[model samples]
Target chain A: MTETLKKFVAGLELDTRMLGMIGALVILWLSFNMFTDGRFITPRNIFNLSVQTASVAVMATGMVFVIVTRHIDLSVGSLLGLIGMLMGTLQVHILPQFLGLEHPLIWVITIVAGVAVGVIVGAAQGWVIGYLAVPSFIVTLGGLLMYRGAAWWVTTGQTVAPLDSNFRLLGGGAEGTLGEGLSWLVGIIATIAAVVMMVLSRRQKNSHGFKLKPLWAEFTLGGIVIALILGFVTVMNSYPLPKGAVRRIYEARGEEIPQFAVMHGIAIPVVIVFVIAIIMTIIARRTRFGRYVFATGGNPEAAELSGINTKLLTVKVFALMGALTAIAAVIASARLGSVGNDLGTLDELRVIAAAVIGGTALAGGIGTIYGALLGALIMQSLQSGMAMVGVDAPLQSIVVGFVLVLAVYLDIAYRRRAGQ
Target chain B: MTHANAAHPLVEMRDIHVSFGGIKAVDHVSIDVYPGEVVGLLGHNGAGKSTLIKVLSGAYKRDAGEIFINGEKVEIHNPRDARAHNIETIYQTLALADNLDAASNLFLGREITNPLGFVNDDAMEAETRKIMGKLNPNFKKFADPVSALSGGQRQSVAIARAVYFDARILIMDEPTAALGPHETQMVADLIKQLKKAGIGIFLISHDIHDVLDLCDRASVMKNGKLVGTVNVDDVTDDDLLSMIILGKKPGEETITS
Candidate 1:
């Protein structure tokens, strides 16, 4: 037990950002419950918070890459709005006749179109920054205004609403009883596959004459991850929308079991956010491209002298950021069942702040996708919990702004101390 | 002193003149190096010994001069041209990125890539180890970044890089400036190894002891002008210092002698 305690402390120390964020989260939760008379801790509120945070967190993952390169994308919010508008326009005007596509296929086409637009815009900005040697602040600042104007022009300053039911299913719909069971099965299989991969990688490293972490370290980390997943499943099962709640649909249908029975199972948006987080983490940690990103951030001149095409790497990072912004835009539009010129207004600051708070250095060379996700969660929770406590929207914004400043100050202090 | 082709100089610079911002940094200087020879370039802080080597390394464009490599006039306008002409310079700053490993520094700006278009780490490591073995076998920095390496080890890596790329003419600026006695010896041994390989070296230094110990010929400069090149065997440290300080050969001028 003493050894286990020591190991846990060591792990927590290794993950300073996560531990700090978790502490902040706990504090925020307590304050929220105290102010809301415990309503903030309700299952319904938690589910709503998760849904709302997903879009920003997804966007924040990409923002981390840009920030790590010591660059800023002030235009992410405007770009997201523009992409969302474009997606809505495609669905309304182009999807049915131009492609002869049905519901789900049309959604896919819309997403692809959005992402393509994002990539083009990102590439254009990246080219200017990388080749022309324009400051990212100026380039992305120009992008902010330009894309916002384009979004307004595309949508005619109006909201596009009444999306197809299939499209709505992506954001608002929950899994059916059978679907929940299937998701649980898929989740278990994925966990197993991940474990196998980790074991294989460890073995490969061992064979290659590299030092492997102690078996206990590896097993403890793996076990904790599995435990978290199981805990999540347990919480989901206990919710009112559990698979067991699907009996209500059968009762209404006057049948022993309803064929279309649905519970308030995990929403697609939640699943999407989780999957995107996982994939982004993998991409950041496991790929050569990811290593290049870190290397470029660490010392661009050194990287260049090492024969790394830093210009291309910068362009690729921005392009990836754009693609992620588009994905976030789609999710936001789907959740709202509409798209508007104001869809992502001021979200850029929030995402950047989240990344910063999560320990992404303003000076570049240090950051992680997981840190950005946690940062987004902290920001989103503040907003959601404040709302539950009857705080006005503008006040909530002020609070979030103050927290962002505090987080940045804390980060600076930590960095200085670490240096000493 | 008795090496083969010692009569035929490997590199000859005639009336080399270089200026920076209208100031004559190297004015009417000439020097030569024979195969397997170490030519020490001596000067005060601004006496233009470095400027002359910069011209040779193609880091600076000479205003008026001609450089002959093996009796053929060569125009070197850039580092690439210098490399093509087998001229390599190891500056006082070393020019090795500290964050990179020895292998990466060895292949910086020209990495060997694999068939899949990624840097060939194994090949680079093998080449680095092999070359380092010849230069400084005691240098145990195989994978560690150059930043962590000692001054002598860093110099070893820089020298290995130049030699590995087939540099026939090597220019070293203050190679042992900051090194201790042992480290300086390590570099001196490496320089001897280079001479044995038939690579002509330009050893730039202010240390007369180093010049006497390592150089086959000592060339002193004063106020952007060549004093004279003397066989190291024939000159003393005080003679070289007099040439540097008084702007005249030690015995050739009555005032100095």
Candidate 2:
């Protein structure tokens, strides 16, 4: 009876760990708001924070899988750095001289090469771990140093500057993925899609004779999510920078500005992360490949005896990690607008912290994409908040460290209390 | 009673040899199991019975051996190869992924999927329910991970997995060792049902009483080699024990228990 009540209160059925992490994120946000005297919770700051969290959040999503399979990759930071520098060279120097800056083929080739390099690097590492029988720790640890060295070697420790304008926009510029009206349209469409999916899934579960949330509970969830989406659109629409092109003309004429809103929508990288999260969630929840991954992580001996190719799974996981690292590289480079020797310095620690904080088991066989993203958000929020409050960098690190430990400790205690 | 199956054993393992780091785990042991027959492998600990059966289940590669199934020579290289031959083993450990639910464990490698390859979880769960209904009617918690289940219940899930996959040759390592008396009876009935369906079973057990109650033929092994295989009706439990303990055939020595 108590369990049913609690489930009803939650409105949406989710693992308590996921709920707790989300709750922690909320608490973290509120505390930051209090610390910064309401300056931190503004739509602009939240928007910026979301964009900034994209790189680590994206990598954290993939890291959840790697860690779930009872393996670790310490080379992501270096891989990100190397991929960023390689893209930088191609976009700013190599391609411009050959194909010219405005040529459409240049961006296409550079982007394709970037993804190819990531896959090849990942596949090679995966092959070594899966087929050649090298332990992932030793393999990726070697990758850490080798890739970092390669990053330095690529441009001889020089910073590659002024990436393409199109690429620049993806890193979170004044321009947006969608205009103001289109943003509202997408938001409404997404909310409708969510409701439709809920209905279909509920029908499927009912057909399977599974107990389901009551109609009121379902309605409450749909209402909350739709409200949140519309709210987010409202906030983005209020950013008010590129006001209809007429505002810019009026300003040029030294005339009074008209009271109108022009929206830049959400950042492209943020949208990319959203799409990636959706695809990953479906894969994790609905696909055979995903089931095999969890099974292999849960028990390698059982998985192998059940005819799952565990060694090959290990390799594929690393390859996917590499592919995601390359994607992160694109975002990081675009955001920085310059590729430095230390492009992704010490970033592996951040995503590892995020993944674990989101309740991914160090012991393996458990993780979620949303959990890791929320974990990333919490981490970035603390950093961004502390910086806004003029906290010393060293002190911020100490606080962040304590927060990560505290979050994980609380999660462990909760699981124990719940007898998980 | 079928003359067709009496012509040849469903499975024949000849002179199986497996070594782990120069230690002969299974050495020159041979066994044959006929269809619709329960062949009890009786041995003390370290007698290489489990190791010997593992070679047929494809968990371990025999250094020297030729396995013939259904009157044809076939190579058993890995678990996948063994599965292709419809051979399944229910290990003493149950070999379940504890984090996955019973249905997931039941369909670990072979999952039902839609056109896009997304697993049809509903179909899998329904199938699991149908099979578990036959194997263990009292089973209720289909969504709970195998780790959360009791020893007997876990055994049911493992058995359901084997039977659902259409396995013709079943190898069970101490299937009733951890089960209670009531649960053990359930397995006994299940064995009878499988026998009725003409499935061949290799029941590896240290329980002499169980062997007497269930086995049609008893093969005793000692020190990685087979002592002898005898008809259960032709010998007493004491004779089987002597074969197990003294590595002698039944007629050679009898304890007269």
Candidate 3:
């Protein structure tokens, strides 16, 4: 039976580590559902869980590259806080004064300004790390403190609120989602794209006379992917809008409320996370930049001898991390409809934890964007699960801390065994 | 194979000087190689042979010198510039990224890309397979990282990388140090083939036998200075050892081709 199972796994061409992580996730979800008496697995809770995971998950994907390149950005959380504050100030105080309070372009300008600040600040820090030859740990730690102070100074530690309504949609709410029809359409299109990509890759391998997976194995993998995407879309489409929200929509539209409720297919923030995951995965796998990052991490002298501009690559990687933090800030602030100095406090730890648990080696040269996303999901599940089980805040923190160490220890053991 | 005397030298490093802080790693050292000629660089530890060659390979910027390729002066401030002039080096350390597979390390900076500018990994793997098949017929572990390979396998991977790029100027630093006798013979044969193809090679080695068997000429360095250059046929093992050990040139009576 073990031999047959091994053959089945090999036939699917799946990474054993990835399968293990998925298995763990399923088990975790089942236990959580049991603890909540089936409440945790409901469509409503799952949707909320997805939205909650989005912000950290987005940043965690970028952290994979950072850690893979043998660097750390201790400043990401503070950077998010600073960017969120800047954005809140722009949309709330500055832009409204110029654009006359509710201009269609206010949200766009605010977002652009926030992202610009993030990239510039991030690149500046990268310059110091790469060109100045300073350790990344020290530089980003300084940035952590400096940016947190800067965020506090933005509004003298006061909260900025009443942001532009359109911007809030990016944070994902009852109205900030793709409806039932659009969500299914997206899932179908994604499924088709994935199959086409697999087929094209197989053809490419064939042309090059490389080994290929069997046809039945390929079909099975395709079937699995289709089932996953469709399953997710189905769950998302089952969650109907709350009664108050439905009534408000009718009242705003000057129409009587319908007897039936409309489904909230998928949150905008969740879609953003998925899109970012796809883009980051492509960048990590297909681009020369990604290759150089890993090569430099593996051996800096080798990369330099190979004609790679490793210093410049470092700067670019850090700048990319900064940009991602800014996006996370947008989601965090928009979700709350306000920005405070404490908006992303302690988020750096969560981001790092997620990346580590996802199997980004601190020693550098290996990581996956998808793995980091899954890691973030696992972290959020643990936190929310504990909360639903009425665990105290301190106890939740203790469990998370223990789980983080345990997961990494297990991952290291797995790697040692598989590699041997 | 004999290099043409009248042919322009494939590589010329004129009066190269490299200093680190207050120490002179290579001082006023000059060397040249003609097409189809292999010049062995012999030296003691810290004798500055590698430093001088690094100037030519663009691994180290010379404080003072000019590099000429095929009689034309060229700027080689970095490895990219060296590669542009078709110069490739296999260092003593076999500078392969340990985390990457053979194909990734082979193509490295110069990857095979599709029209969309994405790396064409399959094409690179196929090319790597073809080359490794010729270079080391037993090398079948293409999917494993270089770190997992045996020392000899890793050395061959480094050699294949330099050879695959069609380098006009090849630098092999202790290329056979990690190889078994059979692999050493294979490399010697490969060098013969590369030399017959008119590639200029700088072979750095501690083994006098390898120099005698493979190189056309030998250049000895001591205390960051070149002692002398002599034809391999004109010098015996003791004569070269005297030059490396005592900073002395071969006796006048020993000057014979």
Candidate 4:
């Protein structure tokens, strides 16, 4: 590579794994777009894809920390199921009996109850793994079965349904999307925030008496970020709804078709994903806790000798995983407008696959939250694209499995070349 | 070159004994290191030098012994307790987080933080650069993880971490074992600087040249038992060798203890 190209890549401050993940995502999107005859890249499909990718992406962020710590949580999917059932019970049955369905308190109480249950469950499992010295794989594997069985027992294999309107809104139903104008404003604010963060970090690096990246490089990065954010907002703002829905009111009054704004912008789940991703990235990059996590993962004995409480860090990572799983449970159940005994079945594998595809090593000590998010998006895109192309469901699974293995194999090869 | 009077020993290990599965790995060994002194611990592999030092560094719980730091009895149940008393150990393995950058590894368990409780990476990198400037001026690759670093550079990072933490007592296990000649000289310069600052160091080594050149005193162990500690100027290299091989000190006749 040329010196300038090397400088540009270095100045971006992204490791090769992140760049690889992004490259793979772009290629996947383009290939899917071709397969779907341009439909995969359409605004509506993209918006729906973003919504579909949110839950797995959220859990994948937490899974990065878990897997980085050289552990796994096989129970997240079943845990999501159990938590979703609890959320259903709280919102659909139990809460209405005490507080009226329309009362705003019901929402707050149900959400809190769901999250609290997740935390307690997660922490208990973590404690068993950390303090009791049980291997994490066996413990969580047991939890997988227990939580799944409990989800079924909670309603005797019955489905819980008809969640409140506010809950459904959180899942990106018609009422859940931000309008175009608000989305544009949000886009601008986010761009400004990105630029400000960049400037502040560069200044901080300068103050640290280190070599600074060239100003042109920084400006180029800032420009790309702003363009991407604005472009995304533009796409989301232009999703054309069905003509029938737009003209129904006019047709009812025997009138001409009126220009109608589409029912789309940024869905609540997408916003949730973005916010969670940002927070998780910061925690993984900027916090002392994050450093300890990486250290423990890289060399546990070294970390312990350095005086870090690796056991507590393990518990905390798992608890965070559980908490995110709960959030995923809420969004998933809300999206379907009901909770089933089999809710979130097989989701744990998907989340783990996403993290691995994003360059998180099973051997531990390396991963990025954004990479995992993009990994989740890539998988979602492939699924949605294949479905649109009329591929069989079983064939889709085989392809995804092969892609996952290929991604990991390529990552290992890249690392070997880099001599990691 | 010795301040042998009045200044108390920085750390004193008395009759320390540690066992594994009913076998004495470190037999009743007593050692003391004074401030501004470099005590070379010479022994063969599995001669118990590492285990003996591990007792003081709290890497192992002594089956029988007492440890005193600065003339006060201190109980060290773990590495944290050793760190609490400013005792730092650099294992032969270097014990660095390989996936972390030099700054992150330098400040690994104890990171400098901003008011928001976030690890101040900039401040850490700055401090790391400043310290490396003092210890090893040629170290410039702060952005790369320590795993990508050369052996000499990795050794420099480990040395810098212990030195930066203001460790009053330092234990180095075969620090130069994996290093090149130039890097070994760099470490010698570091030991001199640290010595001038009154930091006591226990230098464990199998290299007689390193021990003779860098240490003020030499103590040899055989089969988990201390043979004797001799002033470098008072004993020839042959005498140290005899003490190590035969577990018998020079000028001793009909004496076995």
Record all residue pairs in model 1 with backbone atoms less than 3 Å apart, i.e. clashing: A241-A264
Docking class of 3: medium
Docking class of 2: medium
lDDT of 4 by residue, A1-420 (tens): 699898778877757777777787788789888887888888888899988998899899999999999999999999999999988888888888888875677767878898898888998988999999999999999999999999998888999988886787778765577867889989999999999999898888877667887887788889988999999999988885567755764576698886766557888888999999999998998898889889999999899888888888888989999999999988888888899898999999999999999888999899989889888988888888899989999999999999999999999999999899
Error of 4 at A274 (Å): 0.8
| Model 4 DockQ class | medium
What TM-score does model 4 achieve against the real structure? 0.94
lDDT of each prediction vs. the true structure? 0.79, 0.87, 0.91, 0.88
**Clash numbers, per candidate:** 1, 0, 0, 0
Candidate order, lDDT descending:
3, 4, 2, 1
State the RMSD for candidate 4.
3.0
Instruction: Return the clash pairs for model 2, or none.
Output: none
Q: Write the per-residue lDDT of candidate 3 for residues B1-257, one digit (tens) a residue.
A: 36667367889899999999989999888899999999999998898998988888889999998888888899999999999999999999999999999999999999999899999899999999999999999999899889899999999999999999989999999999999999999999999999989899999999999999999999998889988999999889999988888788876444211
**Residue A397 CA error for candidate 1 (Å)?**
2.5
Candidate 1, residue A392: CA error in Å? 2.9
Q: Which stretches of candidate 1 lie over 4 Å from their true place?
A: A1-8, A11-13, A30-43, A100-104, A164-179, A208-210, A237-266, A270-288, B1-257
Question: Which stretches in model 4 have alpha-carbon errors above 4 Å?
Answer: A1-16, A240-259, B1-3, B252-257
Candidate 2 ranges with C-alpha deviation above 4 Å = A1-7, A10-12, A242-259, B1-5, B253-257
Worst 10 residues of 1 chain A by lDDT: A171-180
TM-score of chain B of 1: 0.91
lDDT of 1 at B77: 82
